[model samples]
Target: MFKNIKNDLPASIVVFFVALPLCLGIALASGAPLFSGVIAGIVGGVVVGGLSGSKLGVSGPAAGLAAIVLTAIATLGSYENFLVAVVLGGIIQIIFGFLKAGVIGYYFPSSVIKGMLTGIGIIIILKQIPNFFGYDEESAWDLEFFEIDGGNTFSELIKMFSNINPGAALIGFLSLAIILFWDIVLSKKAKIFKVIQGPFIAVVAGIIFFTLTLGNETLSIASKHMVSVPIPEDLSSFVGQFSFPNFSVIFQHEVWIVAFTIALVASLETLLSVEACDKLDPDKNVTPTNRELLAQGTGNIISGLIGGLPITQVIVRSSANVQSGGKTKLSTILHGLLLLISVILIPTLLNKIPLAVLASILLVVGYKLAKPALFKQMYKLGWKQFVPFIVTVVGIVFTDLLSGIGLGLLVGIVVILLKSYQNSHFLHIEDNSNGKHKIKMTLAEEVTFFNKGAILKELDNLPSDSYLQIDLIKTRYLDNDIIEILEDFLYKAKERNIDIKLISKRGTVENPESFINFFKEKPKSNISLS
Candidate 1:
């Protein structure tokens, strides 16, 4: 994990900058103590990063789970009670790891996953627009379509234009320009520019901008518009920020229900983020899903025990890490350590950093995920892939992360079924000297019941006094329903004066009486994974 520390170190600084505001914002959105979010960030980084097989994925208190945490905290009657659920949730996640439930992540289609990444990217850009314009009414970490105060994503976006601050906007624009310059021009010009990433410089520039224009009414960034971190006055007060879970609620049914809910949601979000992170990894490294579950479970347990919200592999920070050239888990761990060290030693300095600066960094991350080139590429792949991808993106933009992915998965399944219905077999007609149609039908590799409609329709439309050839030479698994259909077709063929020929590994028959019997006798090659 430390092998690429030279690159990872700088990447960690970028991730640290990105993760800071997010930790506070997500906790505020979740209705948890602000310090709890920082605790989760630390746990996610140091604990999960150390244990996870994913080098690029950064675990933290996720915005996706903020709503759940908010509702759970209230329903359970107390934050302490919520802590009990989080601990139990971690245990359930560990059990999931042992059960190898991580394979569930693979079931999501590639198009859907890509759509998820794009959707998140779009959401990040949308949510941060307000912050970018210096409209800081809502916590930037809120991910739901509807805000806690009843406004929707677009509504807030509209609200931002009226509240734009010149100072913050200036800082944001300059930060973005600096990042672009460093990324597109300077980084290519020298090795030093590569070592010191643009996002870090952008953040430093934002701080300087905030410090330089403190008293200017037209240009000064407001304190409310800056990064907010809990500043402990002394060592004792810092230690007092930590809270322990109440074990008294361990036996309560409500606690158990909340625990299960958290476990399920956290596990799902983690799996999806890790999958997305793997796709973004330049090395194409495959994160071990089960091991990731184990790591996250352990991190969540530690976080929960110490008054932190539930933890998951967060795509935002993870992508920031990847975009900033993070090569290993060292970046993730270092980012977490930076959070800890900064909160303890430089809280006042950290507070001076503008939210607009962080928003600009995320804007870059969001743009990368939902690049126009990707849309063009998906469109060129055709509707089968594009439909699900678009649906997922729309769902996420209009709804939330998991909801959008669910809609996309449903669409993906429908697309699969539609393709299956159309792709059952290939038919070719050859003119015969007998003035009759000689049709050759080659069955697909895997013929399931879904193909019954297409297969039956073709068989029923066969011309009278024609010759029909059914070939299964390359077919690996022929469904019993299809076999029965073929058997029934044999009886109909005789009445229509249609001569039937069956071809397979089982040998050719001039007029096969029973396809059921032919497939009942199978070869080792003829197998169905289903």
Candidate 2:
């Protein structure tokens, strides 16, 4: 893991910068103590990163869980009571790992996954716009499309334009330009540029810019517009920050309910992030989902014990790690250690860094995830892939991450059903010299309940007084629902005076008395043709 220390060290510093504001912002958004978010970040990096089977995935207090944490904390009556739920949620996640529920992550369609990545990217860019312009209406870390402060995504942007702080804007734009220049021009020109990332330089430049513009009223960035970490005044105050769960809350039914909800949501978010991280990994390394679940569960348990919000594999930090040239879990572990050390020692220094600089760094990350070229590529794959992909992206941008994915998954399923309906069977018609009609219906290789409707429609539409042949010669498996449909169609064929022939791997039957009985009686494989 330490073989590429040069790469991991710089990537860790970049991820640490990206994660710090987010930890604080998410903590503020969740209505929990600011220190709690940092605690989760620390555990997510050190503990989860060490235990996880992923090379580049980074775990932390996820923005996706902020709303849930807010509601649970309020509903539970106290933050300490909420801690009980967090611990129980971790146990449940461990159970999920044991049950091999990790396989569920593999079922998500590739189009939807890509859409999720793009959607999240778009959201990051949109959310960071407010920060970039020095509009401090919401926390710099907030990524929700609908703001907790009672505004939607676009409305906040409109409001931000009117409330821009010149100092912050100047720092943000200049920092962004520096980052872009370093990434596009300098990095390719020199090897040293790769070792020291643009984000790291941007953060240092932002601090210097903030320091130089201190006394100018119009240009000076406010303290609120910069990174804020809870600085402990002394040793006792630092110890006071840690809170323990109330064991009495363990017996509360509501606690269990909240625990289950957190476990389910966190596990899902973690699994999705694992898939996304794997997709983003330059080496194309596959993460073990079950191990990730176990790692997350353990992290959440430790986090909750120390008065932290639930932890999950967060895509933002993971994506940043991948983009910053992180090669192993060392970057993840180092980032956590940096978060721990920064809050304890150099917190005052960290607080001086402008939020605009971090926003600029994220802007680049967001652009990479939602590049326009990806849209063109998806479009070329045809509507079957493009529709779900676009829907997922739009849904995520308009709503939230999970909701958008659900909508996209629904669309993907519908496309599958439509294709199944159309391909259930092939129909051939022949008109003989005597004016009699002959029709042949061939079943697909595998016919299930989804194919029943199409098969039924074709059988009912068969012309009267015509010869009909039902062919299942190539079918390897046939659902019972389809068998029932064929059985019921026999009465209709008799009513229409149509001669029907049943062809299967078994022998040809002029009119099988019973579709079920024929399959049961003739267990041996046979080829039948009319």
> Against the true structure, what is every candidate's RMSD?
2.4, 2.6
Tens digit per residue, CA lDDT, model 1, 1-530 = 55799899999999999899999999999999999999999999999999999989999999988998999989988898899999999999999999999999999999999999999999999899899989953557787788888889988988788889999899999999999999999999998998999988988898899888999999998888998898899999999998889899899999999999999999999999988999999999999999999998999899999999899998989999999999999999999999999999999999999999999999999999999999999999999999999999999989899999999999999999999999999999977758789999999999999999999999999999999988888887877788778878888888999988888776787836454455555542334423
- lDDT tens digits, residues 1-530, model 2? 78999999999999999999899899999999999999999999999999999989999999888999999999999999999999999999999999999999998899999999999999999989999989863545666677777888888888887899999999999999999999999999989999999999999999999899999988899998989898899989998999999979799999999999999999998999899899999899999999999999999899999998899999999999999999999999999999999999998999999999999999999999999999999999999999999999999998889999999999999999999999999999966545658989989888888998898888888888899888888987777777777777778887898888888877678845755467555332331221
Off by over 4 Å in 2: 137-139, 430-434, 512-530
Model 1 worst lDDT window (10 residues): 521-530
Query: Clash number for model 2?
Result: 1
lDDT of residue 269 for candidate 1:
95
What's the TM-score of every candidate structure? 0.95, 0.95
List per-prediction Cα lDDT, in the order shown: 0.91, 0.90
Could you tally the backbone clashes for each prediction?
Answer: 0, 1
Cand. 1 Cα-lDDT: 0.91
